[model samples]
Target: MSASHPDNAPAATAASAQAFQTRLADRAAAMETTLTEIFNRRSAAPPRLLAAMRHAALGGGKRLRPFLTVETAALCGAEAATALPTAAAIELLHCYSLAHDDLPAMDDDDLRRGQPTVHKAFDEATAILAGDALLTLAFEVIADAGAHPSPDVRARLTLGLARAGGMTGMVGGQMLDLAAEGRWGAARLSPDDILHLQALKTGALLAFAVEAGGLVAGADADVQARLARYGKAVGGAFQIADDILDHEADAETLGKRAGKDAEKGKGTLVTALGLSGARAICDELIDGAIAALDCFGAEADMLRHAARFVGARRS
Candidate 1:
């Protein structure tokens, strides 16, 4: 059959999507193994804290952030194994965020990844300590000699992740979200305001995934910049998709509470723009994400697929 035949297009598209999913699953599984190894090596921590950390991080989830790190590094010509430490570091930080986010003082959710949240599974203080330990452990993983051969690279990765996880990024965004909920002061946020909040909260760490990948690969400035742009675009699209899911999906499907955004009066793109408008913006971000990858060749197709996947995902 002709490769260009119209009859083959649908089959080709399906095959491509399947291939992307397979690759995503493979990377996700690899990241799970990496996390396992990390825990195995650090077994001397307090038993309760270790149990809470393992419970909070180990069970299930897509592991999207780590996959991004591995893939971005591969695109820059680094091996998957070489990216594992940095990737694991990012996942540790993400798990820490989730543990803390579900604390009584925060979102107070009872479930995560379809299981009891850390606080519920353990105790409030243990959960807090677990979160704290996981957060510090992220830097520990990234700073290891395994992450990179050079001190310069290690330092950059450490500094970059710190900024991404700190007040200038995710923490700052969380503060703004609380204000949206009237914890400090309530105010109606415009679309731009929502974007800013999401950019800081959700997008910063995501963007750093690729930035870390580039740093790991020792890619030049132009490549790093392009990866950063793609990461930011995908981060924006991912958050919008998440907001849409909260509006439409149930808790069972989301593996966590659905519609908490509404309950907390959190401002989102979906709230600022209507659902249809939010979808439009999501598509635009996906377009921008793909465009950012034009500098790379076929090696970046997986990334392009990731952007499309972000826009169309249901949960």
Candidate 2:
């Protein structure tokens, strides 16, 4: 089937949706194989450390961010092969975040991807080290000539990934999240405040994922900006969906402890807006994401499906 779809058609029919799912699974498997091989080839690391790193980085999850990176690159007319390393780099960073986020000092979760979390299966210190190693490796992956033949493209990917994962982005938003728990006696965040926090903490990397493709393909400035906007909107929808699921999903379905946000007093959009209101916001963000891709015409149908999937996902 053609990747293109009419602007007014459903984002995906059952068959097309299955096709998208197949594509997502294929990319995810490829990413996992690449990650596993990278860890297996490392001879200098201690056994436990290597095992922990491999455990945290090599398996599980939807691989959505990498999918976005590859798809966006494809949409921008670049070959998927040209973008695979960068996609892998994004997944490495994402896994690093998940490992760290599940630490005792953070979300304190005991499960991830239907397995014991890094900190649970391994010692906390090892988990922390593994996360750190994965994070650092992400930069190395992006900066390597394998990610892009052009030195400038590799440099741009490195810089963009750094900014997206740095203090002013994911880390900064995490800090805000901790503070919102009244750890420092800060007031409970308003709806707007929660939105801003999620935008930075969760949205930044997603924005980078979409924009990374444009960067790799050397898309013009306007196209890049539009993709960035699309990323931001989708990111918001993703978090809201997460919040909704947290409130409603079981541990088996969610692959983590549910309702921990409220238990920990973390300020979520759901907390500030209520369930129906949060759903409304999620829908709005999905619409905005789809609109942002209007310029890409039928070439962006898969991305539009992704936006809808994020909003409607049950887990």
**Model 2 alpha-carbon miss at residue 237, Å:** 0.8
Model 1: lDDT of residue 224: 89
Candidate 2 residue runs with Cα over 4 Å from true position: 1-11
- The C-alpha RMSD of each candidate to the native structure, in angstroms, is 3.6, 2.8
Per-candidate total of colliding backbone pairs: 0, 0
The TM-score of candidate 2 is: 0.95
- What would the per-residue lDDT of candidate 2 be over residues 105-197, giving only the tens digit for each residue? 988999998899999999899999999999998898899888999998888899999999989889899999999988889667889999999
The 10-residue segment with the lowest total lDDT in model 1: 1-10
RMSD of 1: 3.6
Where is the poorest 10-residue window by lDDT in model 2? 1-10
